[model samples]
Target chain A: MTRILADRAARLLDFLWSGWAGLAALALLFACWQAGHETWGDFILPDPLATLGATWSLAISSESRGLLLLTAQRALAGFTLAAFSGAVIGIIAGYAPAVMRLARPLLTVVLGVPPIAWIVLTMMWFGTSGATVAATILISATPVVFVAAAEGIASRDRGLGTMAEVFRYGALGRFWFIDLRQAAAPLFPALALALGTSFKVAVMAEMLANAGGVGGALARARAMLDVPQALAWVVLAVIALVVVEYGLIRPMQAEIEGWRRAAQPWGVKK
Target chain B: MSAALELHRIGHAYFGQSVLNSIDLQIAPGEVVALVGPSGSGKSTLAHIAAGLVEPREGRVTPGYARHAMIFQEPRLLPWATAAQNIGFALRRAKLPRRLRPARVAEAARLAELEPQDLAKYPVELSGGMRQRVAIARALAVRPDFIFFDEPFTALDVALKRRMQDLVIAAAEEAQFAALFITHDLVEALRIAHRIAVLDLRGRGIAGLRILPGDPGARDEATTFALRQRFLTEDPLFRHIHDVDERRRP
Candidate 1:
């Protein structure tokens, strides 16, 4: 019973160490915000409590809540479409040299074009709806994903591939064991970037399209010249980005990286 | 026993340069043939052609064996897989059912003398000799009719090398699998081979083939050492290699 109590105490210490570290960092950030509000005055920076009140009020409103959900839906749809299409094309371009040569120049052109330039054309085509926002996000995010997937396939170990061939690994086996494993290391980071970019592009596109979302809420706040309300909406968007990134994408990435680390020299031995 | 592998006047070139020219060889079932020469003497190229990993520019290779596998100079174990998993990879597509796969992997591990703890460890966690043993285990797990060893024990220490040599002889005796072992080490060739072929790089084909009169299984260190000395001094076919090395010495 004493040993069990000791084990529980040890685990509790580890739990406190991990969980409290984040809370401590958040407290430090709030302290800094409070200090800045006092120094900069209400016009430039709102008090922490006042900002929290505004954020809470805006968060509960029907229109603002709907806008947040709509933005999230747009981002998800665009990111999914981009990830799927990019992965397919990337795998083909990575494996086949002839296809890569033809596709590379076109992808470069697409990557180089600004998101704002594409917004005009997308708005004209889709007419300021969810489709227009999703299209903008897709156009912004696909190239980064494509480049990462192609590089991952190209850098795979040829020896392992040859070994796979000797074992008569059929198409599915080859892809699952060799191709996908090789591609995974680079693909995860690209997915993270694409996910983040989709959110930014969706919100930007929504703002310009005057579509119903957080961007539309920002527009209404701007029309009224309510600086604190506008700031609150911007803060909410940032919080959403952080939550999606750290809470969702980051943990998934950490899981993959942990698997990779275990497969590496030091981690496995330890 | 019939010939398990037959190569007739096989020729191969790399980027307009002839690496192997008019090479002819044959290995009977359960026979162990060792090909020895200096570096870049086309021994590896011949082995690669025989393994069907490379295409010959001329002549034909008739593979009478049903299955084949190779152990390269490096262990070439998959870094992502554990030792047991690496060996099991060879059995992944075999007709063996899932229930028997783990047993087969365990048997191969036992044959290779790998510890249970080592079996769960990744390649990077293993020593140089251990990794090579894992490679051998992987090859054996496939239950191939023919196997190729391309300087597979080059990186091992003397004791580890001798142990691996014994393992190969034992495995070959038990399984009756023909092997084409390539190496520059005359001592290694004498310890493992039934017949030794000297590849003549200057002459563009096999210069000499000597069938050793004794069994590899019964040969002791004295006999192996004697054979090694004979290969260096008395073997006319290997004189050129000795002379080249002597000239290159500072």
Candidate 2:
């Protein structure tokens, strides 16, 4: 139909606008990099061509691929543990005021401590393994999720809750229909932040622990004074972070938020 | 059958200040009763108590039927739920199987005159009138034996209000369920109520009760208007209350 064609056309226009904007931004970035490279010469700054060559070389190597996969595995494991435990503890704390009160001081203490402060203790406990690295990541991200979930539950509309009670919707039905739906919007942003924090903290923990992963490769490259290779690994890590964020976390968020999208703008038309 | 609802000297207070005192009322099955009073006169409080949302501190409220539902002053639809989903919430606890819920929801939506496209929309997406209709649909979906309306059409425009009033009358006629409708609008109260109960703000018991004589279906506008004037002036209590409300109006 004509309406469908118009909708498709509008979508295509939005896509083109996004693509052009990104291209313009990238061009500006490349110009800055080229100018910096020229001023500093080869030792302090590598040319774009040289950086790309180094990145390609690293990408094709079997050892680099294994290191990348290992780093990804550690991030996934730590993020999974944090998300599962955080959601369970958060829901319980949200619903029960007594439990929330009991846990408040402890949660504050845990959230305030720097990641470095816990790194030595984690290393002492787990002895320079992936487990220690993962523990540090989990400890760093769980509080964010807890706060969001708790606030969401606290502010639910009491009138709707009363309606639910009048309908004789038992505990489970009440939770699913009223409580969970109210909590989900706040929970998504917290989950996204936790996911991003997992990847960043995992890399930092791996580097500090001197574990066998991309961090170890970076450490070795630094020691050998292979600055270009070290920078290449950093670039690889950034790319991995972007990929994981967009590919994994974003899709999950979209799936969870589909209902919200369908709700759309209700009032006056713009 | 006994009266659909009975209130035995019901009284309520907040912070030692009495809102309702020694109230006694009874509504028969398939009857519509309108409770009209000034602001802060405890009309809404009585409705809430009758619907079992709030319990009175003193005396008993006995409903002849077990099932009851309410429509508040505001629509009070859940922001997160679609029109269909919100209506379905009222039937969520029903004894019907899962597959029958959609049909029941559809039936209520139809009764409320909700359009197909609007059914998939959220409360925020609808206009004030549309949202009010959804709220009405939700209450009807429960198939309650008793219904309470607390100024349910206050936010609507004149045409929409008339449409909603007709819908309420139509529903009551079809279902034969008892209703306690609270409103400050005399015209609205007269149009729908089988009997009108005027509350004395200074005292607790009903000041007066007027039983309307002709069938709503057969009555014309002039007859209804004349009846409204007769109730306002011929009844001594109504005359005093109307003068006081007019004096108090800013």
What are the models' TM-scores? Answer: 0.88, 0.84
**Measured with DockQ on alpha carbons, how good is candidate 2?**
0.37
Interface RMSD of each: 2.7, 3.6
* Fnat for each predicted structure, in order: 0.23, 0.36
**Number of backbone clashes in candidate 1:** 0
Tens digits of per-residue lDDT, candidate 1, A110-200, equal 9889998888899999999999988988888988888888888878777777677667677688888888877878888898899889888
Label model 1 with its docking quality class.
acceptable
Model 2, position B239, has a per-residue lDDT of: 64
Local distance difference test scores for all models: 0.82, 0.81
Lowest lDDT sum, 10 consecutive residues, model 2 chain A, at: A261-270
Badly placed stretches (over 4 Å) of model 2 are: A1-35, A38-62, A92-109, A262-270, B15-17, B199-208, B215-220, B233-250
Per-residue lDDT of model 2, residues A1-270, tens digit only = 795476447645654666788799878987898899999987777877788789889999998989988888888788888888887788888888887898789898998899887777798999889998789878988888887787778677767777776677767887888888788888888888987888778778788888878888888887898878887887888778778876776656654554565455532221
Give the deviation of candidate 1 from the true structure as CA RMSD.
4.6
